[model samples]
Each structure stands twice: as C-alpha cells, then as structure tokens.
Target: MPGRMERMRAERRASGEASFFYREVAFNADAVKVMPGEYFVHSEDLVITTTLGSCIAACLWDRQAAVGGINHFMLPGDGASDDGGRYGSCAMELLINALIKRGATRRTLEAKVFGGAALIAGNGALNVGQRNTSFVLDYLRTEEIPLVSQDVLGPYPRKVCFFPKTGRAMVRRLPPAQREAAIALDQDARRRASASAAGSIDLF
Candidate 1:
C-alpha cells in the first residue's frame, strides 16, 4: 500500500503538483521558513515551518473552507507601532484577513498554538513567553475560534512544521544547542520588533 501511494505521489509530482505531502521525503520537501513576525498561508499541502523559543506561533484552519495559515509573532501586543507582524494582534489579524480574502470563513476557523518558553528564568526580563501564550489564548477566545491543540510554556524551544491544507502539524523540541540558538533568535526578534523590515508572507 505504501509503495503504491509512493508511485501515485511520484506521478503527481511528475505532473507538476509540486506540493503534495509525501511523508518519507517530507523533511526535504520544498518549504517556507517563517521568521519571527512572519506568516504563510495556503489552500494546498505545502509545508510552512518555524522555530521558536519565547515567541508564539499560531496555526489556524477553517474546516469548512479547507484553508489554513500560520503566523509567528515576536511580542504579545502592539508595541508603539502597528507596522509589523511582531505584535500578535497585528500578526493574527493579518493571517485571519488573508484567509478570509481567500474564501475562508471566520465562523469555521479552528486554532492550534505553539511556542512561548521561559528560556531564561528569573532574569528580571519580561516573561515574554507567558505573556505571548496568554495573549494568543485570549485573542482566540474572544474571536470565538476553538482552540483544538497546543504545546506552550515549557523550558525548551520548539521547531514547528505545519501543513496548511490538511491542518496537520508536527512539533519537535530542539536539542540543547539548537535551543540556545532559538533563544538567541528570540531575543534578537524582541529587540528588533519595532524595526520596519518587512516580515515574510510565504505561500509554501
């Protein structure tokens, strides 16, 4: 059965449907690496991936519309400026609006959230992770979106891969070394959250 599916997928790929999910080779499939304050949306099976430590990533799917999107935000709320995806509010709005424009209905949206880790404890720094987790949960609740799944508020970082069309996700806790790198990236993203560099909008 697996071999037969592989042959079918190969034929699909050969015919130029480049984004179908193939489990065995999925790690090497064409992918979009979403940065902090970035998002990706698709009505197909393209992979959207991100790494997070203290930030949050939200994956939203409209079951009826069969479309989904994922966003990564550096901060919990708007920070003096509304120009970037770094704020969860802005990031969430962007993804929701995009999905709606693409024929998804807000009434059918469901959500899965990830990330928000306390990497550096007791540093007098803002507990950004907890804040991010709280903010997103509240936002979704207020918007009436059902929270179906989540893995948040841990001591480790995570790498998330989301399949938009199927609304399936895989999350792996990073190893210690890569966890440290994710912490570094999270700190950098927070520091530069107010900057004007455009965050990405990827289809795959």
Candidate 2:
C-alpha cells in the first residue's frame, strides 16, 4: 500500500490539481526526472534531475524550509503565449509557487542557474542559449530572488542532479557526442516552435 505522502500525491494527480502540463510519468524510486518544459518541487531529499544543451535549468531552494524545485525552460519568454511552466515566465512562477506550497518563503529562496551553452556548431546568430541565460538572470533580479550560484554559457551540454532537502548537487559535462544529441533536441524544439501558429510560443 502507498504511504500517506504517496496517497496525497496520487490524489492530487487524479484530481488534476498537480498538473505537469505534459504527461505525468510515474515517479517511484528515489529520484524524479524533469523533462523539457517541465518543473518539479519537493520537500524531500529525493534527487531531481534534468539535462541541458542550449536550454536552461534553474534550481531554487530555501534552506530554512528544506525545500527546492527545478525548472527546465526552452526559451526565455513565452512571447505571445500564456504564462505556462513550458515558458520561462510560467516556469519560474510554477517553481516558485510549488516551493511556497512546500513551506518555503519567497524571500528565503536562493538560486543556482545552469545550462545556456552554445550547443550547435554554427548557430551563434540564433542566440537561443544567450537569451535563455539572460532571461533567467533578469527574472531573478526582478523577483528579488538571490542567485547564489550559476554555471551558464559555454559550448558543452550538462546534466544536473539536485537533492532538495539536502541541498546537494552534481553536474556532469556530457561528451561531444552527447552534446550533439542535446543540440539536436533543442533544434527540434525550436523548429516546432517556429512552425506553430503566431502567439503560441512558450518560454520553456
């Protein structure tokens, strides 16, 4: 039988109150994986993980509350679309809201930003990574959230694993081959975003 915490989580999902915005995968074991355009917050020490190439993932946690969340955004802003976690605006909002719901105060939040690498070989003109990098920084500044650490802007991909309650983190730099894979992922996302109708792009 599921424990009390598991029962509450299941109830939330069944009621559609805890929307992942995308499909919610089964989260068992000791770790949770967040996909692009997704975010998760928790008060446990369970590992929250994501990978990034040109995209950006921001990890925010409150020490006193022992809670944290991570968000992976594909772009900087939602442009014309509504604020959704898939976009940076909505993503940040969702993350912040989740943390608060987990007993964290907005003022006590500290951030660690990652990703925003120049993943592709010759797409400097696009500046997707740069935009993502700056957008999060601007968002944090405006929100008055202290940025405690960041590893942004480069030419390689990264895999980030964060433990919320313990505030422990691990970053692994993917090799060139895997970096290319990351680039491919972003390219596909960008292409799809461009193909979508006007006023439909999200920040993530």
Candidate 3:
C-alpha cells in the first residue's frame, strides 16, 4: 500500500484537477484573520476551498448582479469566547458584510452552505461536525438569510469548489482515509488554538 505522504500527494493532484482554475487567495492570522467584524472583496473569478471536519462554508451570491463569494469557518461564535475568527459567527459575518458591500441586500442574496462533516469516529455530543452544522443553520435562520441550498453533515469529508462569478458550488466527498486526514487537520487546528492561548507560535 502507498504511504501517508504518497496518498496525500495523490489527493493533492486529484484535487487540483477537481478544482476550477482561477485566481487564488488565502487568509490567515497575520493576514488580518478574517474576523466577524471585517470583510473583503475580489473582482476576479475566484475559487475558495476548505477541507471540513467541523468547519462550514457559507456561499453568498447576488444572482442579479452576477457576483458571489464564500467564507470558510470552524465554529459558530456566540460572542461567548474570543472566537479567534474560527467560528461561524466570524465567517458568516464576513461573508454577509462582503456581499452587502458588493451591493447585495438580505432579500436579494442567496446562500449555499457546505461542510460540517462528522468524518471522524465519534458519538453525537463529541461530533464537532454536527455542532458546526447546527450553528450555521441557527445563524442563518436568525439572520434571515435566504438559504438557497446546502450539502452538509455526514460521515464523509468533503472538498468544496465555489465559483463566485456564477454562484456555482460543488462538493466532493472524500474516502475514509481522506476523511481521517481531514479530522487530523481539525485536531491540528485545536492544538494550534491551545498553543495560541499559551502565546506559542504555529503555522499552516
């Protein structure tokens, strides 16, 4: 059998082919850590993808304007914690704000939610995927954002591809071993959170 690294490389190659070719943009802590209070915009044909275990992506589109955008986040921030921009609160906020800035109103906006996969082996309470999924749904409901569609919450990891220009999003479920890797990525995120609390440095 192929080793872990070999498998990862294969997946990367496959993902490259699966994804739409376009201008890429990446965000992180030092790069202003896309918080709930902030927003951004891009005019190019954009593709945003994030692997999921407990995280969720909110894709917002202004169909009449022919513009769209997506945000990826890990939790549903309820103003209870610092959130560190990992929660759905931050993600949803950024996405909505970005759309509003792009001239999209609540009534004119359409949404597609993705991720929140329980790809890890676990029970209900411990299932971060389920929690994240619930968080996003509640947020959208309270915010009154018309949810056009969704593909979320299952035992399989997913790779998402979103085209902002056309408001088209595709999700591909990863195999079991790939799902395990996605869970590992989630664990790594948690570890980084702990390290951050201790004033330690970590990077992706």
Local distance difference test values of all predictions, in order: 0.78, 0.75, 0.60
TM-score of 3: 0.70
> Largest lDDT belongs to which candidate?
1
Summarize candidate 2's per-residue lDDT along 1-204 as a digit string, tens digits: 876445444555311023323221333436666777778887764677888887788999999999988888777786435535556787788788888988999999999999998875566556789988999999999999999888888887998988888676678788977866787788776655445444444323
lDDT tens per residue, model 3, 1-204? 975334433553211012222233442201111211222333345455555666677778887776776666654554335543455676566566666777777777788888777665546576667777888888888878788899998777777666667788777888876766787777676554444345322222
Q: Model 3: which residue pairs collide? A: 75-87, 75-88
User: How many clashes in each structure?
Assistant: 0, 4, 2
On residues 1-204, what C-alpha lDDT tens digit does candidate 1 reach at each position?
555336544652211112333343556554657788777677865677888998899999988888988889987776545456778898898889878987898889999999989898774346788889999999999999999999998788998898888899899898887867777788788767745543432100
Worst 10 residues of 3 by lDDT: 28-37
Instruction: Quote the lDDT for 115 in model 1.
Output: 94
By TM-score, rank the candidates, best first.
Answer: 2, 1, 3
lDDT score at residue 106, model 2, on the 0-100 scale: 93
Give residue 125's lDDT in candidate 3 (0 to 100): 75
RMSD (CA, Å), each prediction: 7.8, 4.6, 10.7
Angstrom error at residue 45, model 1: 1.4
Error of 3 at 152 (Å): 0.9
